[model samples]
Target: MNGPHDMGGMHGMGPIPIEADESVFHSQWEAKVFAMSFATFCNYFPVDETRHASERMPPGDYLTSSYYERWLYALELLITEHNLVTPEEIEQRIAKLSQEEY
Candidate 1:
């Protein structure tokens, strides 16, 4: 069984296998992060009234990337917008991580 902060188990679903290297997050925390990021991204672009209400629309090319990629992009945007992380620091961290093998 997982603790309060463990997100290994599927939400309202059966248990999900936990990989040895994956970082476990609190389900609530993940939900909050997702909501925040999704809302922020939605606000980034103007809505298209012409599009059908039920039809799903994709974000711009940049946001259409993978889930983690979109998260990283949103994080970068938030970091810069809030002045939490400097551009130089982001570049340095990216370079360092790129050199490391998974």
Candidate 2:
């Protein structure tokens, strides 16, 4: 259970900056990710499952990823684990979206 995600009492991580009047989400995509995660939580996965999935992410990746990125990783992991979607399908979708952005 000890991982980069479990930095509860660790030190030398730097100070947490407090931003006044910070929005719940810094971007539209973050809000969308939250909405997606929430919906999946209610219907397919429990909150703890998602939390654990996020924790299971590669330590290097977990350390560098943003909060919402971690959530996305969890969602993808759970969905794939349950066979709701395949990894190749997810990769294809990402490729499609990437092409559309051009």
lDDT of each: 0.50, 0.93
Candidate 2, run of 10 with poorest lDDT: 41-50
Q: How close is every model to the real structure, measured as TM-score?
A: 0.39, 0.93
lDDT of 2 by residue, 1-102 (tens): 899988999999999878899889998889999998999989999888888999999999998898999999999999999999999999999999899989
Clash count per candidate: 0, 0
RMSD of each: 12.9, 1.1
TM-score of 2: 0.93
Cα lDDT for residue 84, candidate 1: 67
Candidate 1 lDDT by residue in tens digits, 9-98:
437745646678765444554665567655754765333321221122233533244444445455565556567679899899779977
lDDT of 1: 0.50
At residue 80, what lDDT does model 2 achieve? 95
